[model samples]
Target: MTMTPSLPSFDLQIDRADLLEMERDVWNNASVPARLKIEDNMYDVYIRYRGSYTRALEKKSYHVEFEKPGIWNGASEVHLNAELFDPSHFRNKLSLDFIRDLGIHTPNSQHILLTRNGEPLGLYLQLESVDDTYLCKRNLPPGTIYYAVSDKANFSIKRKRGLTSGYQRKLGNMQDDHQLIHFIRSINTSPHEIPRLLNIENYLRWLAGAVCTMNNDGFTHNYALYLNSEDHLFSIIPWDYDATFGRKVNGDVMEYDYVSITGKTKNKLTTQLMKRSGYRRRYKGILEEILETKFNKNYLEDKVMDLHSSLRPYILMDPHIHSDIDSYDREPSFIFQFIEDRKAFLRRELKKL
Candidate 1:
């Protein structure tokens, strides 16, 4: 893999014991003073660079946009992963790039490498800070709601038991789907410059395509939904890509399982989502076109291969940690599973449509 001139040499040289101690120190006391502060009607926002279990050595931002950023961003906001895992393989930057290339909605980001003692320590993807002031000032219509996690919020509750446990909790809750459908219905009822329902469908299809492409760790607590004053709803912009691009180990090969698209209830909800007439008739073609154009197996293969190449050396130097990275493979069956299962659900739902 060709290395970018800007990227520093991949030379991580700390023993397992030393690494653990360092990790503890960093997690225990790794916070910086807030540069800017903003207050929206119901929330106080603070932004700070921090670390996480998923990406042990890196620094990323915590945005506290609400009193609580859900169960994930809890008071113990900064901590080391109980286990080590590779950060998203520059996944945020890659996802932003891939999404923009395919014409999807994403916040802007730039790549920066965080260092300690003037030596490269980890990579950070700096994103454009978005606050509710901007959302309110934009003049969104009544009943349109915008949601985000405040920096002080604890999202860890959702993931308390582990990744799967967190996902199950989210799936069992009707509130997510209820809120989502409510937004859709609001769009359907409201008068807007754009065809609101069509926009919603387009976003869903785009999100599905993104899942197929990256085999991403799909929407958990961090996904944000944005609604304009005009009652036009946009898809939730993806955040936290540290576990994307087929890099996860110990998972099923099926794309549906690659993320959290499992369980009978989620299956039913997914079926209902895809079965919507607007999604089935008007948006499926566009989704198919985009998938064919931007997210074929070859595309995913090339991208993953490139990422593996870039990160391979760093990973190899640490056998224990790198072994986890080596475990993931490009399984075509994953994509097929997603298509087949979603197709079956859609077919059943379409009969009613």
Candidate 2:
């Protein structure tokens, strides 16, 4: 007899209100000392707390990082919230994991579950913090940075325009010919002995192909690229996967094109990306390969189910995923309008190439 791996189990029917409440409880009661502290960095939430038995002895909590603050506090280990619960999001993580497992330079991560008051609240996948060393080690231009904007955080490109400094400067700008050249130049340089530009381009095209095949909403803000001091550039690891798996708009799959904002204006990067024959050709292959994968459907479905099973019980009592459902719903008209405008913008820009 052969033994099959037992699938992970979770609850998907929980309301959003319960999830939020649980999040609050965990925020309040996790074993952090009173002297421990938390600070919001605008980009991410940071927490300073008492180290665990293992961490205390090592005095290395300073080196320890979690994807989301306190996400690991009450759990046996830290993990990302999306990977443990949200089905669509989890599938995205699995896709990324598959990519990394296949030798891609994706950020490292592992699944984790969070509980509070002796009850399961939710799940998260903890990610290895990609240090500034990874960025600085590469030789990049003076002003190179990366960012990711998500619906949950309202960190879209449009929203980022008002922000200043760090990664924000990279946003809020339309793509132009000169900017395109600079972007290409930055990535093409040899950073830390790595073929920074080529690898970054390859990954972008690859991601585009994957997004199309999976019917994922690959918004420009959802992806990023970074430059290091070594004059090298690399693709920032991807995040957020809750809106994938055959999700479509207007009978057409949602394709992420950073070049166009609502199909009207072209981002500087998009113009350059379209001009690259190598990127276009590779994108074609990526889409084809994604569709051709032997277990594509099964893989996706199983991933969703696995995530559902792992988070169901805990999510049931949490309010974030279920209770406040109305808060999560976006007006379809607005999204469609943006898509239509962006498509038109891309069409015009593509013709320039």
Candidate 3:
């Protein structure tokens, strides 16, 4: 039997009035000052509600920024996800870890318990914020990061709002926007030159990860674009994946065949890439490799079982879960079925490709 790991708790001390103010306006990005106790030490931090749609949830996710840099685990800022939509609470972690294992850039994450004003909140998945700190921690060269916030983030000149960009620049100046826009224009006009501007292998690996996990929201949005300062190449990083693995972001169960093998085609990058025989062949090879290794039912069974074993007790203690304990217990089987069904689907699709 796998031993249950001792979960760390974050005790937050905040003013009731401020907390109420935040709760009243769920869309407000303003943060309130608070003191957080972790183990034996206490740190002053700024706490704010995080996520879209999740803010209205009874158990809210949070974004925590330390007053001082490198205070907690070398991260100046962190995102504590309530994972309200995921019954298993392990899908996001599993997906991110799998992407990282593919040698792609992905945010690190762990599960932790949370409390506010001495009142127990619930379990949360703590994610390292992707910023300059992320690059520093990985010993990578300085780069600019852009978050694909909306469907308009699809690489195209014409957008829904008549805007040229749908990304939030997380780590760059206005000049970076010009560079990114040029790259997007190139994707349409000069598809063959994409290999020079983008890291094709890394991007394909991330695509494979998204496809395997069945992250229906991952293609055009729910991901980050990192432009390396040294290589002048853009690479993708996975994000916001709780709505994956046979479930929608609204917690609705989805059939294993929900997302197609080619993934979402709303984005021109993927459409243009797949049109070429070379990129298609490469992507198929990546899918085959991952399916043979990590994405298969046999390979993922232990991961699912181990995560369920460690999280089941804590999940039972959580008061915010919408599903019953029996439903939570059955999630592993659902995930395994998804793995089997998705693998078979992809195999057939690969042959057709």
Question: For this target, which candidate reaches the highest TM-score against the unseen true structure?
Answer: 3
Candidate 1 ranges with C-alpha deviation above 4 Å: 1-3, 8-84, 117-120, 127-198, 214-217, 247-272, 300-353
Rank list by lDDT: 3, 1, 2
Candidate 3 has an lDDT of 0.87
- Tens-digit lDDT track for model 3 on 21-135? 8878989999998888887788889999989888888899999999843468888889999997788889999889878878898999999988888888888999988899899
Which 10-residue span in candidate 1 carries the lowest summed lDDT? 34-43
* Candidate 2 lDDT by residue in tens digits, 16-89: 55435434543232332111121212112223322122222211122223334443333222223333223232
For each candidate, what TM-score against the reference? 0.51, 0.47, 0.96
lDDT of 2 at 50: 22
TM-score of 1: 0.51
Residue 149 displacement in candidate 1 (angstroms): 6.0
Question: What lDDT score goes with residue 184 in model 3?
Answer: 91
